[model samples]
Target chain A: MSNTTHPDTSRSSDESAHAEVTVPRSPELEVEQEAALRLWVILSRAHAAIASHAHADVARSGLTLAEFAILEVLYHRGPMLLGEVQRRILVSSGGITFLVDRLTAKGLVERRNCDKDRRARYAALTPPGEALVAELFPAHADAITQAMRGLAADDQQVVAEMLRSLGLHAAAKPLP
Target chain B: MSNTTHPDTSRSSDESAHAEVTVPRSPELEVEQEAALRLWVILSRAHAAIASHAHADVARSGLTLAEFAILEVLYHRGPMLLGEVQRRILVSSGGITFLVDRLTAKGLVERRNCDKDRRARYAALTPPGEALVAELFPAHADAITQAMRGLAADDQQVVAEMLRSLGLHAAAKPLP
Candidate 1:
């Protein structure tokens, strides 16, 4: 692929500060880079191990991972605007729309007009969706608990808090 | 979508202990399950956020994430068996074979027979692959370091070690 062009290079100040990224850097910076990569690799492996079990458990319910994720959000948190669901699930608007539509076709989810806004819509799990999640969630939770049995409960707590902080900060900004 | 059967139920002792997973349980068990779920959600979010930035950086080089991952493995660690590469990258044997073939076609990688085993083959980077990775790796590293700027360097170190332990333990056993 001819990827010599960098769209960001023509962009404004936010990216230009990182113009030095393409070139060589100081030893300290290299160390930081290597450390970050190592951390990411470890994080990826841990997540992969845990997610495999979680996904398999969800798959037993005949639901895709994203589908189960949407259901779980509604089952626990109650009905919410489609936008809110999208945000919570970290999916694009179109992606959420497509999934909700599919779940709706499966008679698992429904969309309702929002009272607060004429243009907004809410996604709620139908009785079938609720029942399915209710049936499947416990097993899913157990699978996660078992997958995460790698760390002690106390250590899981610590890592949970750390990941919370890291995720919040990560969402707040990127590569700056 | 018709996922009514439980294949594991008809199987051995390894899965029977978890038969109770489908039924309701004590509050303590529920709490543990909830804690694990929370940890997993937080981990997913953190990884997604960081990976978004890293993926975008890699995309600028016109290489799919898997392809770049393979090249990086060979670039940093030198030649290795295909099976080892698959394990390190967490891809299936077929998936690694496809990526290696693609990289080889691109003139970035090659395979040679391993002397130790008649059936084993080693994947190594060609000069072009080495030059490409050497050019892109620093930027990729910088991008990672930047994406991970959410945590202090010291905390990154701590999380790295924690994830290392967690990953090792998680890989040791699927579930108990």
Candidate 2:
């Protein structure tokens, strides 16, 4: 994707033409902004790759990425209702339904009617599902580590904490 | 999404075994990891919202997001051929052809025979296309800024820079 064009053209080529609105940055801020932009670009590509990789790995065991995520949560935290899994995975109701359908078909997960709320269904990992996670977690952990390979161990920890804090804050916001 | 359950499963109503695995936090690196995860989550949501917003804006002008990006590039950097645009947008040949077809149908972009390479076709923005960008940019910018509110200016810059750097590195990787 290299744009081997005139320097000026390539430098300002991505966005549309408009007067540059100055969100003035201090020296420290400027450095950070450049880093942040780079990270955004990296994260997009990295995310795509990670999703593809995770999907491929999970598909072999007859699960979709989101379904595997649900299974992973269940494997780590025991049984969870469909709605609870949906909230944690940040998928819509319809999406959760579809995901659960696939997982149920694969026999990796089963839905049991809740005692307290008949409308709710609890999804628990089957024996095979638990086995799969046990086998896959090591590889998945490796992939996560690989994704963070560029950063120092300390920096990676910092990144994780900051990102978790940010995610909690954002999740707390009332969606418009 | 909270898993509030009794410690002893024998006494609890729910039968399934629960195995919650919250990572132990290290004083030195926990914050960084939090930051990293939170950043990814924020970006994911922001990107989803931005995609929707941009889609609506571009649809009004009768173009797909990819085509709009092409036009934006052409408007800012003058005319460029299909291959150059594909490179810049980082899409496959088939994807670019489809995008060009959609843009051409809208009269926002045109393909001209490249003088330098007979086999190549140039994709350039028409005057209407250029004008459309000029009209839409400000509104798009405002929407983006709004979505990114509450992040301090310094944090924004830092995050942007980090993301961009990461993105560039990821983009540079060879496709598997």
Candidate 3:
């Protein structure tokens, strides 16, 4: 495999003042890399574990992850128009419509025309939708807490601090 | 959504003992939870980013991530049979066979019937497969390194460590 480092790397440590602290190379960098790789493998496997459980949860609730996520926003914020939900969730406009349609078909969400804007439609959770969230949110949160069981509070805090930098950097920037 | 903290009983801290350290109650506990949530969000986004890039990479090179992973394993370790690859990658028998078929179709990998075991098929990286890895491994590594930019080395190490623990605990285990 080609291992040549690219020059146009946007992640150049020089550009980001925080780079040096984030990626300190030890004298035996090889050991660190190996550890990092093993960690990555484990993380990937953990992801698969969560995904398997998540799939089952969704199945039990009749909501896919995308659908559940969309519903989650609505559940928190009351009702919002399709474009707004799409914007907040960073999903495509068309995909949001399809998701709303499916949720509506399942009697969980309803779409109503915006009073001010004829062209706009808002999606709101129905009674059943609210019920679904009520039934699922606790279990879902419990699943999260369960997944996080082995981590001590301090370790969790430290890991959180470290990952914040990585996360913020990799986050999807809003459309300029 | 309901936000109930069950004081009487909940397995929220069930696996903490496995960790080398335990954290006492403090303000950082909240930060820890937020950080953990943020990390999950970022990791999910990163997985999507990798998969999306993999889609493009595979389309251009006629290799799926599964196939590429297999070829990569074979590329480094020489030829190996189907079952071996399946075990190493933790993919199902049908999944590996399907991936092998795709790689074979692209002529980047080939299968050789094992002499000792008639039912076993050995798969190896073709010249094109080696060339694909040579061309793509650096960019792949860069994508990961870039995704992790902006964090402190100590933070990175902490993240790696926590993720390892989380990964291991979350992995498939025998029923209690």
Candidate 4:
């Protein structure tokens, strides 16, 4: 949105002199920088669009996005360690604990001690939870399908692969 | 992750009979549903990875992500209305107001009354804000570049195009 060229504009005379000798202009790096910035904007906008619609769908089912995500994961994966659920849902440990507590009170989820590991617990769906997911999963899937309908199947596949690559790459690296 | 197949496992026999007549099994729809779910997972994971790293970078610069976003937009586009800023950043009206207040208190942003429209106000960056962004933007750019380095230039371009299309499509649709 800003037309100003960056890292080059508004430099003091002294800094300019220092930069001239130290910062060698690499056209390739500049191109990469611009590309990365554009990519981030597009990626963020697209994610917001899809998430907003999916969130609305989940809300209509009388569940928060986190609630829906937890139920959906448990519905598909069966019972999982509390830690595993937290990781898969990308929620904070304390946030997951709170959500699990709420779900437990609603009779939608249950926590059970692990058989082999006495200290560990697993979060499992209740009969009601399974029923809710079975009822709502179709609509959730439909919302996603509608959001992505603009892309052809092949395009969706390509986008998914590229995103997976980017996600894995970023996840593997520590923040600098 | 749950390995359980859903909607089919927990149904009563009578409900199954009812579903058999009501819910037609279409292979085409099944494929679409699977693709959509996969895409949502991939998209969310990629967003989380990039946002986590970007948020960390912004934090080191002593700005919250929302604050940085507002400053960046103002830095690029010059002054903008409070509502426009809210739309661009996907923040609530109250959230944007609070952020602007914080920025104003920090002497980085100012609100000016529009001459033509007395009811309208613009939020513009101060010289200090400009200088901070000028100094910090390069690192922000670098952080984005590093996160996206996994994808080749061509791959990045393709992904950007696809995401743009998806975002536009989703944005155009009314929430169902």
Q: Which regions of candidate 4 deviate over 4 angstroms?
A: A1-24, B1-24
Candidates 3 and 4 compared: the better one by lDDT is: 4
Candidate 1, superposed: residue stretches over 4 Å from native: A1-27, B1-27
DockQ for every prediction shown: 0.22, 0.18, 0.15, 0.34
Better of 2 and 3 by TM-score: 2
Angstrom error of the Cα, residue A169, model 3: value is 0.9
User: Residues B55-154, candidate 4, lDDT per residue (tens digit)?
Assistant: 8888897888788888887776678898888777777778888999999999999999989898878999999998887788778888988999889877
What would the per-residue lDDT of candidate 4 be over residues A17-123, giving only the tens digit for each residue?
Answer: 12332355588987787778788877877877887788778879777778888898787767889988787777887878888999999999999999999988999
Tell me how large the interface RMSD of candidate 3 is. 12.0
On a 0 to 100 scale, what is the lDDT of residue B3 in model 4?
17
Which window of 10 residues has the lowest lDDT sum in candidate 4 chain B? Answer: B1-10
True contacts kept of each: 0.40, 0.10, 0.20, 0.50
- Each candidate's B-chain TM-score, in sequence, is 0.82, 0.70, 0.63, 0.84
Q: In terms of lDDT, which candidate is strongest? A: 4
Which of candidates 1 and 4 is the stronger one according to TM-score? 4
Q: Residue-wise lDDT of candidate 3 within B60-163, one digit each (tens)? A: 56555566667666755668889877766657778878888888888888999899989999998888887776676545544444444455445556666777
User: Over 4 Å off in model 3, which ranges?
Assistant: A1-42, A87-93, A115-120, A172-176, B1-39, B49-62, B87-92, B115-119, B152-154, B173-176
Q: Please provide TM-scores, in order, for all candidate models, with all chains considered together.
A: 0.82, 0.70, 0.69, 0.86
Candidate 1 vs candidate 3, lDDT winner:
1
